[model samples]
Target: MEDRLLDKIAEPFNLQLPEYETLEAMIDGILPAVARFSEPNLLPEDSPLYVNSWVRMTDRPGATEVVMYRFQGYQQGEIRVVTDGEIGSKAYEVEESGDRIIVGESIMRDSFLYELSFIDDDFLILRRHGNLANIPHPYLFFCREAIGTRLTWNEALERLVDKYRNSQFPLLAVGLFVAAMIALLIYFR
Candidate 1:
């Protein structure tokens, strides 16, 4: 029965038992820290203590434009957002299975800190907290196709230098001409 329960929970996110266990343990560890903010009296209907935000990044090398949501509540509560790019949607359907969990999504597993949760409806909410005291806000980035394309550092530097050179030559020439005129005026005056 426990296995089945785990399977049912893991089916949507395509998470293995061990992975889910790790996540559960992590949540348990942080629960104590957020307990103070979870008080029913503290949360207001109109201005609930928790705030949700979204973030999408583009124009990075070897990365795709992604839309992610974040929720901030307690000072120590954590959330994670997982996407199809890193973990294919076939494994985890955000629309269908994401509503089952109560927390945020687990996007990437980098060294950077993240807030992870699985909503009841199966949509994952990944919250990233910038400041402890400040209410968390979502950051969304929509990049053009040009911004999505990857450019090597060398190529980018070369392009930048080319542009700088093209734009700077005219300004430099104008400056020199102005200086020459000033010199001539001084010589004659």
Candidate 2:
């Protein structure tokens, strides 16, 4: 059942999970990774992009559906609700069958399926699994320190995401994805 899902998700990214013959293998490989984000408090104040909280770079609405995700322990809680005067006090776990990684409690457990399909120095793409996802997209794009909570990306982030969009929109629509680590270094630097 999930193998077909993997096929659909992996094709565009040009990925193959041939090594893991069954869902259990996928779970075993991903289990240790959960330990990394399981505890965020222990991490240093300055976490590099990959290890830091990844806000949704993909368009949906509001803030990054994922307030934060940690690599190397996972955090437990709800996705943040950052408003003008509010810095959401709590922020979000990982588990379950065929899911690459599942982390957090509350809305997270049932709402998202984060399978770590691709990661480079700056790009992190999660392939969604399960029909439980409330969101519409099959893939969620995120980058560290994305300016969220507002209705839209900040001007700088908007420009950054757009550049990648413009560059790859054509390919993406046709199912050929070209990952551009849009504004990865330029915006933060």
- The TM-scores of all predictions, comma-separated, are 0.20, 0.35
Tens-digit lDDT track for model 2 on 86-122?
A: 5553332444332354533444334554665444334
Q: What tens-digit string does per-residue lDDT give for candidate 1 at 163-186? A: 333342466675676578668768
Cα lDDT, all candidates: 0.33, 0.42
Query: Candidate 2, after superposition: displacement of residue 37 in Å?
Result: 22
- The top-ranked prediction according to TM-score is 2
- Model 1: weakest 10-residue lDDT segment is 89-98
C-alpha lDDT (0 to 100) for residue 48 of candidate 1: 23
